[model samples]
Target: MEFHHLFSFYLTIITLTTISLFHSSKAVNPIILPIFKDTTKPQYYTTFLLGTPSLSVSLAIDLSSPWSWFTCNLVGFNDTWYSGVPNSSTYRVQRCTDDNSCAVYDSNYCYTCNSPNCKPKGNMCTGEIYPPSLYTGGSFYGGHLLAPLLLDIITVYKSNGPIPLGKRVYGFSFGCTGVDDLKGLSRYTKGVLSLARKDSNSFHGFITKAFKIPNKFALCLPSASKSTLNGAMYFGGGPYKLPPSKLDLSQFFVKTALVVNPIDVGETYGKRNSSIEYFVNIKSILVDDTPLKINSSLLVIDKNGLGGTKINPIYPYTTLHTNIYNALVDAFTTKAATMNITRVGQVSSFSACFSSKNMVGTKTGPKVPIISLKLDGRNEDIWRFYGFNSMIKVSNDVRCLAIVDGGLSVKASIVIGGKQMEDSLVEFDLESSKLRVMSSLLRFGTSCSQFRGA
Candidate 1:
């Protein structure tokens, strides 16, 4: 049989078989041929499978906005408003209307800005008579323009330190394609300022012209994933370090800003739609890093019962692990030294054709053995160790196989002599903190004729 055909067959049986059989016996019978009696000899060497586990998918978000005096001022007013009410004053300042549009009388019988518009129309008309002209109804003027007045409130509130009204308050929400877009928005303030100041007729131009100066105060929202910017914060420009004053901006933005989490963004944008698959095959087998030189052949048998065969001498690395390669050098050297097969002419290869169920947990095929051995020798006595039941009967020889999963340890076994052997099971338990070895064995006999029918 050709080597490829033999390897293919081996992979097929193991992948298709799930049921495993275990048998233990002490009887020395005709089929119980033994090549070596020394149990102290080690048969296989160990090596580890190196690879990292796959990473899960994830996402990130960024945001930005405009800074105006109106915003700062509104923040300041709200602070004062909240502070004016004493904590001991338990009475909930209930408004006569749902919108808190009821007036409150102060020490001098002066009415507060409880009305919606503060204009003397309808419910806003206060007939109270203290500080007469103070009833002009402009008390709640700041409340009327609350949203746009935030910029000014913030400016005053910060300049004079914490006001009794609490901290200035502001809020905003928006969406973008990804981190880049978010950064773009954050840096957009500079461009907006430049454009507004450059023109004479634009609204910004009116402010610039009236103030006789450009608005240096720029508003910006913080962005996430600053590391992606490579030690620099990315805004409108490629990358930039935020100014000292803007450093605290991130805190405010993080506190009150509403950003779309990465997971949600991925779902809405359809970015999480990719996957990958993998497959692995063992081309050659070695014991203790030694390559077993076998004069092996291949045989292909199809479901139709038709088969063909090919012959070839298995060299160290031909289709599998090469002898010259450091990986299999020790195994080949050890096997060759122990078998005493010095010359290439001393080895004769044979092919065996047997069908078994591919092995489970194996991706290649079904009812197959987890591990297999091939020998190139004439004396059935020498190759006896490679026979069907030899692996099950021998305890020390089974340590040649290794099974691994997710960097964790798992138990793996192979069928031998028509029965399964627990001692034949191999364990692969290499963690980043620790390492282990994986090895297998092969036995060869003297006289090339003994391997002719294998």
Candidate 2:
């Protein structure tokens, strides 16, 4: 396999074994969502169109998050981003009256089955309510605090190559939340767009089966500075072509089996279910081709379901466990010294930083040491991070190593964040349990912002 180029998946995955949507096929056109990197929340978000008249809502993207919730009329609270509940014939709190699973969920809280609506499920609704999200990232929008599970009509814009065609889908499952639960989220976005695994309970899963499409998606996250206004996301079927050269980005993809982390990373992991988060088996990590001294045990999943490496785009930077972090920073600092790259004062969350005066810029990014992640491939496939993704600029005079110490209590030893993912293609095949990754695309003279972008 070539050592250069990159590919991976999020909600938008390029089809490697593409199935055409013929007139006689059961397939529909795949939905294309333009992804935006919001400086407000310092996170990525996408526009979600929902309901009868179609409310264009902003939603933050969280790959591991289970609920795709938004601020609707949980109470009388009003806003432009909130769902227009009054005139919406399809916007209603999904009642548990017909669901035996809901009744078995919390029999103590179960009541006489009756009518339900946009009314908050506190004391007003008479059926069993789905459990609220964990208090940390849970929901509460109205005076009524039950956080009713909501079923609404959602609009997915199908891709006709670079252009989009709208398709309205019913039976979309999500949570009805309020502004109070919006803490840590962008002030502009109403809710989160979860790209969790395609199990029976997730948003991605519902849409895949509902649309009769494949359970795979791809992501090409863009920086959008001097590039296109946004990035590209494809939900299903694709002949993912980029203009000018019409390069197939998926041709660069190398497949690896995705492992499941048996425990959630949340504080409430014990009370809830095991995490559906995506994890990859990283055999080892290297700096400048010389392997860093790391505990091999930390690279493997322990019996308690801790250790291993996780892929989470919710956070913007890569985080490492303390021991591995210490080893990496030391090795990187030593390698920098060999290159005569002067170190400066430490910045918050980053231990190693340098003065920009001594650095030279190149087409790829700043000239720096390469970081490599060795994955268990047939002939040893390794994902390399060059100058751009490896080093983050903190100030005009300073740039720091783009990795953070994730403390000792974390589940995954290495949590891959979004910053390192920019300008790359990623695809996840839930049906095959495989993760397709192309580490970087800059060398190809094209970035993600230029491919299928807004």
Candidate 3:
């Protein structure tokens, strides 16, 4: 029997799926790779080749992270690390004084010490600490790694063959990560890949320098049911950008100006460090084409001035602010009232549930409503979420609204998560600072590999 990647639909929804970016090869066109989601491990991974000889390492992709690190000579786990050492001539450590080192991560600057050990005035490798990252199961933790950054070759596989992008930096001031504590990490985690900002020696930045393509990337995460890479990711340029006459699914693809979330710079650093958070303003959300009845201000940016909504691939369920959450539940409940379904009790972390007589059947479920998001206050710039994206099938006879409450700890009003993003191609154009959402794959009924992106 095939090992099915199935879990209790309810518990799996709350499980954390942390995404980190790894540096990828740059070519004339976008390099395509298969993303593997393991339901047993509750993890997402993609394979990449690294080092001079090029070895395959399945790494977790995290866009919010700036560090690209893999375990080397790691002990006490049934895992694969980089093993021994690479040729120092090609994969070497970067000095703290190197301009490229500091340029990769401004926070990597070791102000107090001159060296790896933080000597009073010695030159050495820089150390950095990451901000606390949240996993929806009620926990937050931070990790740190100390290593000298290095510029090396990384090869990625496309339909043709292996292609290498040279002189690309492995930032966080290190070629290989040192002994560190990665708390709350998935057991299948071999390394962390980062698609950091352009100025930060990021993977996309390397693509821009090597391929001369726009500093942008697009990704589509497949549904949890499929274990294979039904989804796709494109670097270099958008997968879809056709003319008006050629427009089909292109019309459904909504593009909106990206919003920057202001981060507090440390008083000691004197430099603003950025993260991979795709922050954007959500003007409003609609269920069944009716705008939700909530305070417009609540739907705007946060009190701290960060964008009110962030499209986080790591978070599995869509988390909403308490006020906005209440409004959505009320509205969705009213919409369900019209159907013959009856409101069921809550399931695990979910807010609402429903049950119907026909729901016990294999394919029968509620007449799920359509949910849409208005971006940057533009009515035209809307991203719609269908019934499957907004709701979850908890049991054979029970289905639940997949939304979760962000609670008081969360700053953002809404977090558009993986559940809403599955089966849809979302592009993040760093050059134009815009986000494009499309349902073309479903509209055209084409596989990701066959898309022939423009």
Candidate 4:
């Protein structure tokens, strides 16, 4: 298949200044990455500048994925979309007999194969690493880090911006896989910008330590309806000041402890905590102030490493386990009737959809019964989903609840997807082990677009 999407995803970094390579930075400046909302799909992406000459490669945002990976030197893919890896002089495959092979780093599950006589010395090994497949709803990722100047295009909308790190930040780590890893990927995105918490080795952990910045990052996904406006990601730490008010958006944050589920007895995510995922404690779920009648145990991780809720930015919508979903759908449908919003046949994947003609539209989309996630916190610590966050407009006549059913047998009972997160400022504070969130940025009279390129 011809994989090109026929649209220009030529990054929007406002300006690309000549970066001073090998420069060490210890100044207190958080990095701002311009996260883009894909026009062709329901996804957000950020650009990665790699190779000696520098290439602004677009990668989709994957919150739980351990390492960053992309298609390199691949065939039948867009030239600009995939890495022009072979063209880089510094590109070196990690030798199997050396620092990178499975024998060396067992935590990442790196593997190698002998090329010729099967002797370790005579064989040419590709130090390949396997990433979690479930996060992307795809097969296991067979993809490494090394090569050239993995320079970042610095974006600072404020007076004080990200200061480039010394020599160490020059070499960013990632993997290069084949086309099969392209599952759950849009044609516009080359690969994933994995914000996985794989410590020091993963991009998030590496950048935080290398830059001497705080081990925290902020994510603000722009609305898909506002395709022109870019989303934003604040790496390092924050004071994420956006325009109009230029207020430090961080001040509005309300947080809950970020938990880590233990590794599976079986094969959940082998030796996880290395391939770790971000989980939040879901105490209960409510539709318009009424809690759903579902077993709360399904929302917690079990001894078998099953159940729990995760923040999945790449997924199009928040997903619930079957029982929870059924209860939610029933509650929402009943609530919609009270508001005179009559039900329509299910629109797309949404189990509970309503007629747009009966729905009341507001600045933040149509008014719907708010879906509140009562996380493990004080009674006031309810993360409410407003109209825009709870409903999706499939057509002029139909509006659907953005949440879906992830089937009975699923890893995370509540997978918080992209749709529910739009215009919401989410801060992942690794240092504090807490997820501080500011939901529905528009409700605050500010959109992420206050910063140019979003």
How are the candidates ranked when ordered by lDDT, highest leading? Answer: 2, 4, 3, 1
Report the C-alpha lDDT of model 4 over 297-360, residue by residue, as the tens digit.
9988887667888886787788888999999999998998999989889766676888888777
Models 1 onward score TM values of 0.13, 0.81, 0.75, 0.82
User: Better model by lDDT, 2 or 4?
Assistant: 2
221-313, model 2: which lDDT tens digit per residue?
777632134576666634455544356666677678898767555322223356667889988889999998888999988877789988866
Supply candidate 4's per-residue lDDT for 249. 70
In model 2, the runs with Cα more than 4 Å from the true position are: 1-28, 74-87, 98-100, 103-146, 225-228, 237-239, 265-273, 451-454
- What lDDT tens digits, residue by residue, belong to model 1 across residues 1-454? 2332233223222311211111112111101000101012111110001011111111111010111111111111212122232111111221233223422311111224434432221221111111101111122111111111111111001111111111221111111111221122112110111111112212222233333332211111111111111111011111111222122221211011111112211101112121000001122334533334432221112232111111111001012212112233334334434543221211112111122211122212122222333212111101112222211111221212111111111000111110111111111111111101111111111110111111
**3 versus 4: better lDDT goes to:** 4
Q: Rank the candidates by TM-score, best first.
A: 4, 2, 3, 1
Model 3 / residue 37 / CA error / Å: 1.7
Q: Candidate 2: lDDT over CA atoms?
A: 0.63
Query: Against the hidden true structure, what lDDT does model 1 obtain?
Result: 0.17
